[model samples]
Target: MLRIAVPNKGSLSEPAVQLLKEAGYSQRRDGRALVHVDERNDVEFFYLRPRDVAVYVGQGIVDVGITGRDLLIDSGAPAIEHLELGFGGSTFRYAAPAGVAASVQDIHGKRVATSYPRLVTEHLAQFGVEADVVRLDGAVESSVRLGVADVVADVVSTGTTLRAAGLDIFGDPILKSEAVLIRDERSDAEKIAVLTGRLRGVLTARRFVLVDYDVPGDRLEEAIAVSPGFEAPTVTPLHGSDWQAVRVMVPRADINDIMDRLYAVGARAILATELLAVRV
Candidate 1:
């Protein structure tokens, strides 16, 4: 069976399990269960903390795993990103009490507290800013006020947490991170490929919707231009009329605007339908 690692808890957990379920895998109903086997898929899921996902993959204990990109980088693991899961997006940034620090340059010789010590250390090295790194498991924003560190490097989502701690973000984001599927070079190649394909299909299905419309034969080309799909729009001649029926898959985000454009070009009866699954 192919072995896989998944985040056991935190923000990445629910989404990871949900995506797996969507991709036709069986997940454990009990959150406390550490391991779940999907006999039909011939896959085993090992739930671990998000930070440890890369470690297990790199150590060849699991074939592949889902984890945050920042945690992967911080682990300095041999695993490489197999696929981007496209959720759990956040930025790693440096923060300090307002007016105390304003840029990356200010990090020099300062005590930097962070959960991801390796990531912060390497980032500081890029700027030749040598600082004492204080590694904390959580509540990094409070480090400055508690006098544990002069600056803190941690994941920032809405900046609400930092504001509550009397800290403000300084400089550009050090790193942009999102949940990704990571794989080990030593893992089973065939099984990993199969999983990758299923995930790609699910993500594509979520991103796009099917659109159908009718347009006069003369305006078919214009309608096609407005809603060209992954390859080409499907066109079928209408019965007993100078009209054609068009069908295409368009991005869900742009479906509304695309429909209006199609309508302006003489398209009628425009319809958008949800796609449950798609290979491409």
Candidate 2:
């Protein structure tokens, strides 16, 4: 059976489970359950802290894990990012007192506070700056006010936390992070591919909708140009000899514009429906 590690708490947990469930895998109903076995799929899920997920997978304790890209890199484990899961998005950056430090070089010879000390240290090295790294578990933004550090390099989601602490982000982001699937370099390839494919399908389903419309046979070519799908739109004969039905997948963001274009090209009975799940 394939063993998978999932974040047990924090921002990625709920969405991770929801995605798995949407992909037709059974999830543990009890939040505290350490492990859940999905016998039908021949898989086992191990609940773990987000930071430790990459390590567990890298050590061969679990076949693969779902964790934030920042956490995965900070751990420095022997794992490869199998796929980007696209949630828990944030930026790791350097911030300091609004009018004090204007760039990363300004923090040279100064102390910087952060939960991710390794990431901060490595990034600073690239700029030839050597600043003391004050490691804090949380509330890293407050370190500057409290005099624990002159600056901070930490996660910035909306920058609200940085603003609340009277800090301003400066310099280019150290890393742009989001949730991702990680696996040991030598994990079971076939099994991992299966799970990855399923998750990919669910993500695709969430980002697009099925579009169906009918067009006069004479105008079919024009309408097809407007809604050419992932591969090609499916065309079928309609009851009226002079008309045809077309089915295609449209990205959720482009649905309205595609609809208007189809309408302008002599299409009718246009419909868009959300996809529950998909394999292709």
**Residues 1-280, candidate 1, lDDT per residue (tens digit)?**
9998999999999999999999999999899999999999999999998989999999999999999999999999999998999999999999999888898988888899999999999999999989999999999999999999999999998999998999989999999999999999988888888999999999999999999999999998888889989789999999999999999999999989999999999999999999877886
lDDT of 2 by residue, 209-264 (tens): 99999999999999989998988999999875789999999899999999999999
Off by over 4 Å in 1: none
Residue-level lDDT for 189 in candidate 2: 94
Query: Which residue pairs in candidate 1 have backbone atoms (N, alpha carbon, C) closer than 3 angstroms, thus clashing?
Result: none
RMSD of each: 1.1, 1.1
- Model 1, 68: alpha-carbon shift in Å? 0.3
lDDT of 1 at 138: 92
Where does candidate 1 have its weakest 10-residue lDDT segment?
271-280
Instruction: Provide TM-scores for the models.
Output: 0.97, 0.97
TM-score, predicted candidate 2 vs. hidden true structure: 0.97
